[model samples]
Target chain A: MNTTTKAEKTEKFAEHLDQANIQGRGVSPLTKLDPNLTVREAYQVQLLTIQKQLEAGQKIVGKKIGLTSVAMQNLLGVDQPDYGHLLNGMVIENGEEISFHKVLQPKVEAEIAFVLKKDLAGPRVTEMDVLQATDYVLPALEIVDSRIADWNIKLQDTIADNASSGLYVLGGKPLSIDKLDLAQVGMVLYKNGEIMNTGVGAAALGHPATCVAWLANKLFEYGITLKAGEVILSGALSAAISGEPGDHFQARFAHLGEVNVRFSNKVDQ
Target chain B: MSTVNYQSTAEFLHRAETEKKDVFRITADYPDMTIDDAYKIQEKLVAIKLGQGHRVIGPKMGLTSQAKMKQMNVEEPIYGYIFDYMVVPEGGALSMQELIHPKVEAEIAFVLGKDIEGPGMTGAQVLAATEYVVPALEIIDSRYENFKFTLPDVIADNASSSRVVIGNRVTDPAGLELDLVGVTLSINGEIKDFGAGAAVVGHPANSIAMLANMLARKGEKLKAGDVILSGAVTGAVMLSVGDTVSAKLDGLGEVSFKVIE
Candidate 1:
């Protein structure tokens, strides 16, 4: 059970997170500190951490969804998924060489990225609203990291850890969602020219836009609205793959072209 | 029995693997082998394989699914190394003369985009590091007689890893409902087994996370371009000569191979 006030816990978690990011060393799971921490309190802790990052001059870019698939949800023993805010510092360009030393522990997944042309605020946001909001969709690579040690996290623990959002890459050509069947779009991923995995749009809670719609509605509870020009990563299209130095990754989308990334073998001193 | 050095134990297993013969379980002789001792044996075996000109391709997780865990009566997953020599081309034939007691299972493979060094790796971190995922078929041939062995025995046997065939198709993992991706395995044009990606530790990537964290405990890390086999999604299907096995993954595509005399 929580021994401290909600505000105190939030502040403590924020400081812990900041330290983890700066030190590039993951801390113990937050759930270990307070077994009774609720999801609501966890989000509050997340917001507090995001506020600190904002104070440090990082601008909000968009949001990401985690645990959207039943497998992830079941692994966490949760019925619903969680969301995290993406800041400007978390954006990586395609083909960029990510230094291994900059992050605590990073893994990558393929996703469909949505760049909105119009703002969306929601209490009752529908998939149609997401489609109508109209922007462009592109192939994306999301680099997810955890501040919690060994990923021994509960739903609240990850929520407080900013939903484990790390960095992302947006590449390939963008296409309007209306022109494509978001649910049937085919995707193939490769590592060093070898086929690794394949997926389609329906993998993301039926459609990528549907996930964005869910994010919009979920954010509305906090009086937050998804702003225009933000890059929204719906969720992972397939199982996450562990990365290694000198590895090159490429994802080919049926309609969006290809997105590629490489990791640097040299660790920053 | 005094604890055997990893070298001798590895040598013993290597002979069995290379000579294509079964050996008595190390546990049968040692009786008091520790898990560390077994892993050390595995490491030594991998080193020997490396010395023999087989490159380390990636790592493979075993006993990740609930069915496997239950079958093994263990609560956790085990891992072993995959070598370039272990890869059987898709639709290729595997000679029965080369293996002892071979079996097959469906799996999902993760190819990394970046290196993952973990003291505390998470599933998200695994996803972020991944470049893509693909459907896979793993051939496990236990060197112990009758395919019976203890945990230490199996670990020392390199988790029974023998061969693997990856599907031709690759998919971006973004927005993929990996757990729901159904797998249908056929042998001789008949459905032999069926499962989903979820069978591998709920989601296949989670198994990779578990592998990374587990390896980190030993001061090892998953390198970039490594092709990791998440784990088996179904129970092993016994293989016989003239058997044609095919596994089709829901969206990822299918991989098939034949067992030849």
Candidate 2:
């Protein structure tokens, strides 16, 4: 019943998303481009986009997990989470300002970021394993952008769009977890000096460490080991808030200090 | 003297809040725990939170009802701090998983236009500093089992501060008789309880003035940007999953939230 197969469409969708990002605008959804793109094939599209980024000399520093909430998981009919590569180019210095037109339709989310000290090889990694491997935790602000027009995206569309990853800013305070309880941590997200949202560490699938464990196990099937010295943004603590040019965001976390980033007041493009 | 020291007790209570698990009352374990020791634990707890960069939004009152105070045999009501994180959106869903046993009640909130400090702060001073008064629906969740705790016990527990939903309507207190401000509490489209501002420390402003005096003992003053909750105006109602709670103030508009499993 199909003419263009999933694999064939995967190659085109990868290029399409790449161009969408490059043009600083969103195109149609990947599902609309393929109409039968499987989650597996969408990941293929994601990897190919990474390949394109690699060819442009961007290094893969880490990976990011998305859709960790049960509500989001059920909506996509997935039990676990989908991931996207975090490129070195995607790491923004805390409190730095980026051009507004650098990415299309950017929404910022506050998260708890982890820096790994040991490699997490998957299939049986536990929450304890994650905490043990973590070198330190910090506050993080992730600017999630979509290449799908109007953010009308399905699971496959976002999966192919690299889980809507745009850029991230990490807090300077790197705190150890020896005396800290990961589930007890709290975060409040602010936009333009007003409180936007608040959440606890348990919001990310009961505990943020659990999210890392799930990520490791999921990546085992793809022959990926979460390498050390990598910056892993576990998941968002609160809902992402939309921003306009010149908007500012500050996320204050319990024991983690604060992290902030702002957008350029004027759009060049 | 209490068996366990203040620091360890504060840490344990903080752990329960993080774990969302209820434990035996601190007083149960330390029967000799005095109101002074309870406040010492509370101070240490607040210090830990502030050291962790948690901003204290304002102070909140408990046992403001004379009847409840008389039952507890306490002359002064217990108080706690509301961290910035305890505030939820004006209209939002509160996940039950984040709390142990949360009860909802209507409150009148004061947003100060000017700072007020004191051992001798009066209700008139509180009213004069008031920028506006707004309605708030406070969801109090005690980490203690059965919500049973002494005055000192609740103070150390931050008055069981869990989540608070603020209303958008900001009415100036100068234009209204605060003592006569009546509130009706509803659950799932049914009225549950009703009371007026008079129920709180004779006048709602006096409750905040009392809170001001309490903070004065600690050498702290209410900040201009601070928000003070004038205790519960109605009897606390138990919330269940799928329950829509609405509180309509006499002159102020309604504030509500839905409890989610």
Candidate 3:
């Protein structure tokens, strides 16, 4: 083991996992193969792989955060959140409909959106910095779909599955971040004029700013940087909803504006 | 002093959606099921129901409080979804036998004002996109043949979400301490559950953010105006037919419903 190269070790480990149908548990159950990488470090390996994939061909658009919700952190037995990579080709814009057939298991959620005015560098970012750096805010929708069969997955599995993310729809009007009273903003989720649920921005870690701050800090440790022109979806205003074709979903923000999405029976690019 | 009975589940939900009534009740045959197994089957049933035209609006977080999570034999809270057809009016009663496994919880649901999608987002970003907030009551009904599941099984089942009831929107966020907002859930005039907004992953909004970022990586992002049930602020309590459950939040309003045969 001491004589083996890193690439050799990875290859052997990958083979062993396939042969045994096992994961992790080599040095620790937190990661597989590399004994030196912590669970966090192992995640970095995957991230680097994604980076390389991007370097090779895929376009890097943004990143995703997870476990920010205290419920999920507790459920996964962690205190903070986790994250994964995103590609430019992945996001679906406003008015774009989603097909039920393309997703394995799909769910929907509503969230706040931020378009950065400047680069969000790590190791020194603050909530105020977020405010200063942010250019516009908008209401957004998320479609969560997992490729894993039966949605049977563990934390690592989900991490590998890109946090079970799928498609996204941006709605409503985009407002300057300065013009909005983000903390006090109200939201109403409706399907066909009927209110399904309602909530406020304070529910998101007191403010969506906190969620952004956490992400900036989280990435600093991973050697990742939050660049300008990146779109960030800060958690759900609440739990996600499930929808099928022909259903119209909308989120109405008190001052910022509102966004609406329609689901189609067939997946439309 | 007046009791109203709905003939069908669809009718009950319609009335609840219209805000014409605020009270709803349901009766279930099983009084002592764990809700895990019941939830797994509920997922399949929900898919079928959604396919049949009953839209799944969103999910509710159940057993999100630290105390409630401890009681549930896990460190984290559970989740469940709400459908357009499952809305039950407050103060009204629903049939218990119609459900596989049913439980009641107090939750705060956030209605989105904008469409959101992300690969990397934070709490502040969320607040900026928000419009208003509302108090809600979520009914978790497991569709599993029996309430039995491992931790992951429950997660996949969307935490046994059954239905949701959202009160009017509150326009002020600065006036409320979403994390520590105290709530008291009573059944038939007896307190059955009690907790605060803080119990939901420190704050309900933080939970919503977590879901959003997770979606981003998967090529999916949260849309604006989407209603998100952050998670339950308190624990879930056992409900029987003819039982009335109500939750009172300090600043946010109160939400209540009844269970009947």
Q: Per-candidate TM vs. native?
A: 0.54, 0.57, 0.48
Q: Once superposed on the true structure, which residue ranges of model 1 sit more than 4 Å away at CA?
A: A1-4, B1-261
User: Looking at model 1 chain A, which ten-residue stretch has the lowest summed lDDT?
Assistant: A194-203
**In Å, what is the interface RMSD of model 3?**
10.2
In the range A220-249, model 3's lDDT, one tens digit per residue, is 987778889888877666556777677788
TM-score of model 2 vs. true structure = 0.57
Model 3, which residues run further than 4 Å from truth? A1-38, A52-56, A191-196, A243-248, A267-269, B1-261
Rank ordering of all candidates by TM-score, starting from the highest = 2, 1, 3
Alpha-carbon shift of residue B158 in model 3 (angstroms): 35
For candidate 2, lDDT tens digit of each residue in A1-269?
36466556767788788778677778988788668778888888898889888998999998888987665676777777788889998988998998887778999987788899999999999999999999999889999999988888889998989899999999858899887665545566778986665555655776789989988998898898999998888887657899899999987775678899999998885
Candidate 3 local lDDT, B1-261, one digit each (tens): 222221232233333323323222222322232344334344554555676787767645555555445555775455556677777765556566555457777877777777666656665566667676777777776433355544443544456565666766465555555664556667776555455465576667776776676555446566766667887765677678887777766567777777766
lDDT of 1 by residue, B1-261 (tens): 686788999999999999989988889888999889999999999999989899989999999876567777898899998999889999999999988889999888999999998768888888888898988999999989888899999999999999999888888888676765656667997655555566677678889999998999889999999999999876689999999999877667789999998
